[model samples]
Target: MSKVTEVVAELVSPIVTDAGLELVDIEYVKEGRDWFLRVYIDKENGIDIEECGLISEKLSEKLDEIDPIPHNYFLEVSSPGAERPLKKDKDFERAIGKNVFIKTYEPIEGEKGFEGTLIEFNGEMIKVEVKIKTRKKIIEIPFEKVANARLAVTF
Candidate 1:
């Protein structure tokens, strides 16, 4: 996360929580000529357009007051979608029993990526059940080694 994202996350956390939503992630990035501040949010069943619009309105007002970002950016508030990235302990816990894709900072067990069923998360480690041809294997991944993790949709 960039400094701008960190600061924006701090500013939006309370607002998101108060609205009975979970703050999934925040991204501050430049795409082509435009800078975008994207805020991902979620709830139990799902999120709708109205919820997103409300969040955008509230966040826009707050951002206007604070004027944190020096550059003009588009503020987007929306759902994380099916392949939502898991960035927090709670996210990992919720992802148990679900299919996930995990990328490590370096190679783990001769591989840098794993896509499998997320069997467990113990705050320090994760156990994924991966299928190799006709055989099934369980891979233990240290939490610290995970560079990226997200829910995976298998077709």
Candidate 2:
């Protein structure tokens, strides 16, 4: 996480939790000549536009009061969508029996990316049932090796 994102995440976490939402992630990036600060928020069922607007309003007020960012940037509060990122231990635990896409820092079983049903997550490792050709195989991935992971919508 970048310094700006870390600061913004700390700033918005309380607001998000108070609103009965989870703070999914924060992104502070430069797109062309503009800077964007995107706050991803969600709940069990999902998040609505009204919820996003409420978070955006509350966070905007807080940001204005603190002036955390030196320059202008867009503050967008929205949902993590269908492909929600699995960042925490609880996230991985909850992902069991669900389809997910995982990318590892180094290749495991000669593959860096795996997409399949998450069979298990024991904090130390993840077991995914993937299909290779006509055979189903269970791939064991180290939790520490995961670079990125998200819910995958399988067709």
Candidate 3:
């Protein structure tokens, strides 16, 4: 995470949690001449447009007061949607038995990416059943080595 994102997360986490929402992720990126600060949020019962608007209003006020980002940026707060990234230990736990796509920081079994059913999550590691050709193989991945993970939609 960038310094600005870390700071923004720290400032926004409390506000989100107090409003019964979970902080999914934060990103500060440059696109053309504009800078964007995107905040992803979620809740157990999901979120509505009004909830997102409320968060955006409150968080925007806080960010403006802090002025942490040196560059001017547009702030966006919203739900992560159907294919939300699995970022926390609890996320992985909840994802067990569900299809997922995962990318590793380094190659494991000569592969850096895997998409399969998440069979298990034992806090420190996850086991995924991946298919190679017609055969299926189970691979163990450490939580720390996961660069990214998210729900996969299979049709």
Model 2: CA > 4 A from native? none
Query: Residues 109-149, candidate 3, lDDT per residue (tens digit)?
Result: 99999999999998898999999999999999998999999
lDDT winner, 1 or 3:
1
Q: 29, model 1: CA deviation in Å?
A: 0.6
Residues 23-128, candidate 2: write the lDDT tens digits: 9888888999999999999999998999999999999998999898999999988999889999999888989999999999999989999999999998899999
Best-matching candidate per lDDT: 1
The lDDT values for all models are 0.94, 0.93, 0.92
Q: How much does candidate 1 score in TM-score?
A: 0.96
TM-score for each predicted model, relative to the true structure:
0.96, 0.96, 0.92
Judged by whole-model lDDT over C-alpha atoms, candidate 2 comes out at 0.93
Q: After superposing candidate 3, which stretches have Cα over 4 Å from the reference?
A: none
- TM-score between model 2 and native: 0.96
Poorest 10 consecutive residues by lDDT, candidate 2: 1-10
Writing each residue's lDDT as its tens digit, candidate 1 over 43-103 gives 9999999999988888888899989988888999999999999999999999999999999
Candidate order (lDDT): 1, 2, 3
